[model samples]
Target: MSTCPTCSKPATADFAPFCSERCRHIDLNRWFTGAYAVPAVELDDVDFEEAESATTPPKSDDFNA
Candidate 1:
């Protein structure tokens, strides 16, 4: 059996990873308050422009609908 992430107690069927609703709420609060975050590399303007251009379709001069 897995232990609750918030309280370290035995996990219950009602909350597979948390012992109780309070613990579950505590985990959720952490997420809402930015306690957990996904790491990302910052891109500069040049990198952003290159990525954007690579994905953008080229403009066409044809008049066909």
Candidate 2:
């Protein structure tokens, strides 16, 4: 049997990595309360404009819409 991630008890097949439904709820509560998060770097407007300019095609005066 696999060890439970929350309480280190022997894992049940229903919960897989966690020991019981209670442990699963506890883990969920942690996430809800901001205990877990993916790291990110905020981008600036200059970065967005630069990327947009590089990828976007130039507007043509001759082509009629």
Candidate 3:
């Protein structure tokens, strides 16, 4: 028998790929809540911090340049 992807239990006929309805629901919840997110690969040339800073308004520097 194949193991369940979520809980590592022997898959049941009722659940087929999943061991139980609970495991199925857990997997579904993960998808719904974005818990099972795929990692995004950032390019070496991409400056994420700079991009964010540009979008935000600059704070007043009254003391010095």
Candidate 4:
């Protein structure tokens, strides 16, 4: 018998490749909720922080003005 990708249990005929409906649903939920995420690395610490700060824009200074 083949193993279930989600729970690693033995696959069942009823669930086909998956061990059970629960495992299948869990896998689906993971995809839907973005639980299966890929990690991204900061190529350069200084440039990455600068890019993040620039994209956030600056707070208004109207009160002082």
Question: What are the per-model numbers of colliding residue pairs?
Answer: 0, 0, 0, 0
Ranking by TM-score: 1, 2, 3, 4
Q: After superposition, how far is residue 22 of candidate 1 from its true place, in Å?
A: 0.7
Question: How far out, in Å, is residue 43 in model 2?
Answer: 1.2
**Candidate 3, 1-65: lDDT as tens digits:** 89999989999999989999999999999999999898997845458777776797766884467
Worst 10 residues of 4 by lDDT: 56-65
lDDT of 2 at 1: 75
lDDT of each: 0.92, 0.89, 0.88, 0.88
Model 2, range 1-65, lDDT digits (tens) per residue? 78988899999998988989999999999999999898987779999889888998867964765
The worst-scoring run of ten residues by lDDT in candidate 1 lies at 56-65
Once model 1 is optimally superposed onto the true structure by TM-score, how far is the C-alpha of residue 7 displaced, in angstroms?
1.5
lDDT of 1: 0.92
lDDT string for model 4 (1-65, tens) is: 89999978899999978999999999989989999988987569888888898898566885567
**Which residue pairs collide in model 3, if any?**
none
- Candidate 2 deviant stretches above 4 angstroms: 51-65
Question: Candidate 1 lDDT, tens digit per residue, 1-65?
Answer: 99999989999999878999999999999999999999999999999999999998766754353
